[model samples]
Target: MIKDLFLSGKTAIVTGGGGGIGRAIALGLSHAGANVLVNDLGVSVSGDSEARNPADTVVEEIEAQGGRASANHGSVAEAKATEKMVEQALDTFGSIDIVINNAGIIRMGEFPQMSRSDWEAVLRVNLQGSFYLSRAAAPHFRAQAGGAYLHLTSASGLIGSTSQANYAASKLGIVGLSRAIALDLGQHGVRSNCLAPSSTSRMTELTDNARKHLMSPEKYEALKRMRAASAPERIVPLIAYLVSDRARGINGQVFGARGNEIYLYGQHRPVRMMHAAEGWTPAQADERLPAGLGAFATPLEVITDVFTWPPA
Candidate 1:
């Protein structure tokens, strides 16, 4: 049945294809019949320059399996570099049918002590990089009559996390950017969506370590069990489906992946309301809120709750 979702003759560019989720998706796309342009600067998690070329390894793996691919060593954080990445895909594959913005960096610090540089650095690579790549590839999508843009967000953004203010901000910004793109390019036959995957990767591993130290033994074990349920391959099918004709009817939505489970998130809307002919005094408002608005308030759902087993 997966072959029915084939992307034969289509060309796709996957940013951050060097390793982890990006690498898995790149290979998955290739297996589905898309010619891939694997772009990775081969940098470390913090964006430090490295001499190796991880992109080449992805290209080789695809080629070894009888798929077409090319490698690009460029940082998505820069506008010019991302532009060149698009050019490279066009030159090698002759067309760009899908663009997945998966390149990102994570810098964690407690909110109050978070440095200006740390915040800027995370935004530069995670938020700015997605913007640059999507902007550079939009015109091409328009010219082609149709395309798909899949940006990787995070559970941190969807829910909340501690000591990850910068990461959460960037991820949430990505979702906002994606929604706007979906609206702006819909008439042009372009589809844009955001994915909040719960897969284990370098990012999740780091968060797990932090939780281990911050949580009680039983709570940490529960966290560990939930993480064990997550793996990169569990989310790849969603990526494949999104970029296929099968998903043409879906756009501008945020979906989550955990093990074999796929979940949809509803848009934020007011759950309770209060009104007055004019306005109320602060004291009056405070007194009315608890009986009215506060009565409907619910606790924020934790990760364990979201990914819990036995289906509720």
Candidate 2:
């Protein structure tokens, strides 16, 4: 029997809630008893502005399902705008207990040819936005003596990738930021963690520019095939579990959601150690370090490596 995860009397702000993973998680949180503030800028996959608002659609869906929800179209890229969104949630819902930083955009280009604007656009939404929202909510959380932050990270960040330098940098930065937030807020009953999710969504469809930079043709084909089995909804259970009261003990951790598999990722740790009584010469260190550390070195994994296999 599937037992309902209880989150009654809670209020949440889910950024990028108009569609895809954000939409699914917003609905799930509502079903679990949280009053939701669905925030979406309704931008294109590339972060360009759009006319129709997606957040409204999500709010309507929640209401149709007999759940409470509200909509916000504030862009998380602006710090003040994100702060107002948090305040709006508090004003509308009467309290804010959770913040899911899922608003992000993709501009996949190989590092050498990637433009400055492309890099800044990705970082603005993916990393700075999360930081701004979390910063906005920190004081409120501290006052309440409890809150949760759920950041959408990626395996691309964890292992690195070939064509998406901007995306990888922003995602990896989120993990680092969340870890630091967890450390600083733990005493105040605030919890922060990141979700490295692999699933098919609008994001899975790369732009023409990104496709031009494809490193492995066969891997790209496999990714296209795998999307048939991937569902945005498959990622919601973990989001629900993490934000629930039951998961109060979980903090500053990275968890992976790939199909039915749930993975606990280890933080960066020393794999091999070397010490010299006195600082060794550069030549001497180069000679000995490879033998010790190189033995444990892992080959760099491409972005498609994580998503090429179909979900079972």
Question: Can you give the TM-score per candidate against the true fold?
Answer: 0.95, 0.94
State model 2's lDDT.
0.87
lDDT of 1 at 60: 95
Model 1 worst lDDT run, 10 consecutive residues = 303-312
Candidate 1, 20-48: lDDT as tens digits: 89998899999889999999989877677
Using TM-score as the measure, the top candidate is 1
Residue-level lDDT for 189 in candidate 2: 92
The backbone clash count of each candidate, in order, is 0, 0
For each candidate, what is the lDDT? Answer: 0.86, 0.87
Total colliding residue pairs, candidate 2 = 0
The digit string of per-residue lDDT tens for model 2 on 200-244 reads 778876642256345466765666665655577888888888988
